[model samples]
Target: MEMLCEIHPLHEWRGLLSQLVKMAFSIFSIIGTLPIVIVFGLYFIITINSYLKTKNLSTIFFSLSFLATTLTYTVWGLRVFLLPQYDPHISNLLPYWTSAYLFASLSLIFLDFACIELSGIENKRIKQIIYSIILITYSILVAILFIGFEVEITTFMDVSDLSISNIFVYAYFILLLLFYLTLPNIVFINYIRTSILKTSLTYKKVRTIEMGLSLFTIGTILDGARFPSNIGILIARILIMIGGLIMLIGFTFKPRAKED
Candidate 1:
C-alpha cells in the first residue's frame, strides 16, 4: 500500500450530482459501515469471553475475522476518503503495508481455520495436522504480501484498485484467496444439506447461519472489486454493513460440531 505512490488522477466530478454521490459513498462507508464492523468485532471478542464459553475455538477465529474485517474497512475508508487529501495522517494511523489487502489475507487465514474446526471432523490428529500446515503456509504467504508491499510488487490504488506488477505472484494470491473463501462456503452448503432439523427452531437457526455466511462472503467479494462509480461504492458499503450485522446473528446461534 505504501509503495503505491503513483496516483492515476481520475476525471473531475465537477457536477453537484457527482459530488453528492461521492459524498454518499464516503459517508456510508465511513460513517455507516465502519462503525458497524467495529461494533460487531468487539461484540464477538467480548461475548465469547463473557457468556458463550463453548469449547469450540471457532469463536476465537470468528472474533479475529471481525477484527481483520474492521481493519479492512478502516484502511479502505482512509485510502478512499483521507489518503487523497490527508496523506500525512494516514501514515500516522497505519503502517505502510497495512492495507485492505493485507487485512484480507489475515481474514482468509483465520476464516479457513474456523471452517475446518466447524466442518465436523472429529479426528483430533487430522485437525492438528491441517492447522499446522495452514499456519506454516499463511506465515509464508503473509510475509510475501508484506514484502510485496515494501518492494512495490503489489501496489494498490487509493480507491481500492489492485495493481499487479507480477502476474505469477498475483495469481498465486488470487488462487489461495479463492480456495480459502470457497472452503467455508462449501462447508456451509454441506451443513445446510445435512444439518438435522429436529424442529422448526433448529431449521431456522441453521438458515440464519447460512444467510449470514452468504452475506459476508458476498460483501467481501464486492469490497475487492474496482468501482467505476460512487454508486457502486455506496452499494458495496451498504452490503458490508448488513453483512456484519447478520454475521454476528449467525455466530450467536452457535450450532454444535465445532471443537476447540
Candidate 2:
C-alpha cells in the first residue's frame, strides 16, 4: 500500500501566498506609508543635510537606510510578480536579504535618527560603530546559512517535512519578528519620552512616524511569525494598509520652504 504523504505548512499554496502577499504589500506600502518611514527618513536626511550645511553623520545614516529600504522593497516586489520564472525555492532568499539585511539596516538608521533627533545621543562614532557591527554580524550569519547548507538553493522543500532546515527557516523568521516588534517601539517610546521635555512640532512629526511604525512593525511580526490562526495574515495586511495611510499624512506638515 502506498504511504500517505505529510503536508508542510510552507507547502500550503493558499496559505503561503496569503502570507507572502501580506508581507509584500507591507514592504511595498512604503509608497503609501511615506509619512512615517519614507517621509521621516527623507525629511531627517534633508533637514540634517541643510542644518549641518553638508552631509553629516545623520545624513549618511539615513541615506544608506533609504537606499537599503528602496532596494529591499523593489527586489521583494519584483520577486512577487516574477515568481513563475524564478524557482520558488529562491523566494525564501528574499527574506534572507530583504528582511535580514535591509530591514535591519532600516532599523539601525531609524535608531540613529531617533537618537539624534529625539534621544540627543550625539556620539556619532559610537552609533556608527554599533550599526556597523550589527550589519557585519547579520551578513556573516546569512553567508553561513547560504554556504553551509546541503540543501539546494533552488530546491523547494515540502512544507510537510517540518524538518531541521524548515524549522531553522521558521526560527530565523521568529527572530525577525522579535526585532520588528521591539526596535520601532523602543525608538518611538524613547521619542515620546524625550518629546515631553522639548515642546516642539518636530516631535509631532516624530509621533506620526511612531504611529505608522507601530502599525507596520506589529503587522510584520504577526505575518512573519506565521501564526497558526488563519486570520493572522489578514490582520497583518490590514495593519500595513493602515500604517501606509498614517505615514502619508506626515508630508502634509513638513516645514514649508520659504518662497525662493
Candidate 3:
C-alpha cells in the first residue's frame, strides 16, 4: 500500500499564499479584460459600420479580427475566474482554444491586408503569395495548438509540473516566438523602406506600433515563463493586459499615406 506523505504547516501556508496569488491574478485579469472587451466591441462595431459604408474589405477584416480578439480575452478572463471551481476537462477548454484560433486567423488576415495596403506593395502577385503563406502558416500553427491542447488536457498537472516535451507543444511555441520576432521586424522594415516620403506623423505612428509590439513580445516571454511560481504568473498576466492595451492604442493610429 502506498503511504501518503504528511502535509506540513509550512506547505499549507505556501499553498494558501499560492491560492491568494491566483485569486488576485484572476480578479485583475477580469477587471482588465472587461474594459478591453467593451472598448474593442465598440471598435468592432465602428469598423463594421465603416465597412458597410465604404465597402472596404480591410475594414471588414479588421472588424472581425477585433471581435475575435475581444472574444478571446473575454474567454480567457472567464477561464481565469472559473479555474478554481471548474473541473478540468477538454470540453471546458475548447471554447478558449477555438476563440484563440479564430483570433489568430483573423489577425493574420488583417495584418496581411495592412502590410500590403500600408506598405504600398504594388505587386499583386507578391500580395497574393504573402496572403497565402500567412493562411498556410496560421493553419499549421492552429493544428499544432490543437494537438498540444489534447496533450495538455490528457496530462493535466499543476503549473509547476507543466512540461513541454510534446512535439506539438514545442512546435506551437517555437512558431509563435518566430512569428512575434519576424513579423514585427518585417513590418517596421517595410514601413521604413517602402515609404516614399515619411513624415513626422508617419514616423510617430510606426514608433507607437513598434512600442506596442515590443511590449507584446515581452508579455509573451513572461507568460511562457510563468510556471512554478504564482508571482511570476501574476506578473505575466499584468504585462499581457498592459501590452494588449498598448497594442489597441497603436491600432487606432492608422498608417499615413506617403506624401507625394
Candidate 4:
C-alpha cells in the first residue's frame, strides 16, 4: 500500500503568529497522547504491585505489556508532534516508529498471555510460542526490508505507510501484522466477555474497557488511514485521549465479593 505522506512540517511556519500556531498543535498532539501514557503507566505500576503481592505470573505479563504500551505512545509521539525541529526524517523517525511497532507487538503478546490467564485457560506454553514466533518474524522482516529499501527518502511521512516494492515481502508483512494483532484481540475480547458474570463491578469494568478499546481503535484508524485534514488528526487524538481515560477507569474498577 502506498503511504500518504502529507506531513505538515512545522518549519513551514515562518512568522511569529504561524510559529505560535505550530507550537499549539505540537503541544496538543503530544498532550493528546500523554493520557494514554499515564493510563498505561498507572496500569504498569498497579500490575507490578499486584504481582509482588500475589506472585501471579499473569500480572507480570500485564505489567510488561502496559509498560510496553506506554513506550509505544512515547515513541509514536515522535512523528505525530509537528515540532519545528522534529520533522519526520526517514533516518530519525524510522527507528522510533519501528521500535514503537516492536513495543506494540510485544505488548500484544503479553496481553494475550495475560488474557489467557485471566480467562482461566492458563495455556502459558502456547502463549510463549506465539510470542516467540511474532518477535522472530517481525525482527526478520524488518531487517530484510531495511536491507532491501536502504532507507531511501520516499514520499511517505509515516514508515507504516511505505509502499512495499516486493510482492512476497508485502504479503508476508501483512500476515505478520495480522498475526500480531488478531490473536491478542481475540483472546482479550473473550476474556472480557467472560469476566462480567460474577459481579456488577466486573460488568461496569468490562464495559468501560470495551468502550475505551472502541474509541482507541476508531481514533487510530481515523489518524492512521490519513483522513486528509488537520481537524481529523486533532479529533482522532482527542478520541484516543478519552479512550485512555476510560481504560484507566476500567482498570481500577474491580469486582467485589458477594456480601453475606
lDDT of 4 at 186: 66
Residue 71, model 2, lDDT: 47
TM-score of each model, in listed order: 0.68, 0.53, 0.64, 0.64
Q: Pick the candidate with the highest TM-score.
A: 1
Which candidate, 2 or 3, has the higher lDDT?
Answer: 3
Better of 1 and 2 by TM-score: 1
Candidate 1's C-alpha runs over 4 A off are 1-33, 49-55, 78-82, 86-99, 149-162, 197-206, 254-260
lDDT of 1 by residue, 1-260 (tens): 64344332232334544654554465534654466556766755764673357656777787777777777666665555533322334333345335666777777777777666655667899778777866776777768766753223222322323345576776766676666677777766776688775344444544665576677677666655546555665566567667666756766764455422
Q: Write the per-residue lDDT of candidate 2 for residues 163-183, one digit (tens) a residue.
A: 124657547645644653565
Q: Regarding lDDT, does 1 or 2 come out ahead?
A: 1
Candidate 1: worst-modelled 10 consecutive residues by lDDT = 150-159
Clash totals in order: 0, 7, 0, 0
Q: Evaluated with lDDT, which candidate comes out highest?
A: 4
Candidate 1, pairs of clashing residues: none
Q: Write the per-residue lDDT of candidate 4 for residues 80-192, one digit (tens) a residue.
A: 64333334456655666567666766665676566455445557787677667766886786677557653433332222223445677666755765565455456657766
What lDDT does the true structure give each of the candidates?
0.61, 0.50, 0.58, 0.61
Residue 207 local lDDT, model 2: 74
Give the 10-residue window scoring lowest on summed lDDT in candidate 4: 153-162
Best of the two (2, 4) by lDDT: 4
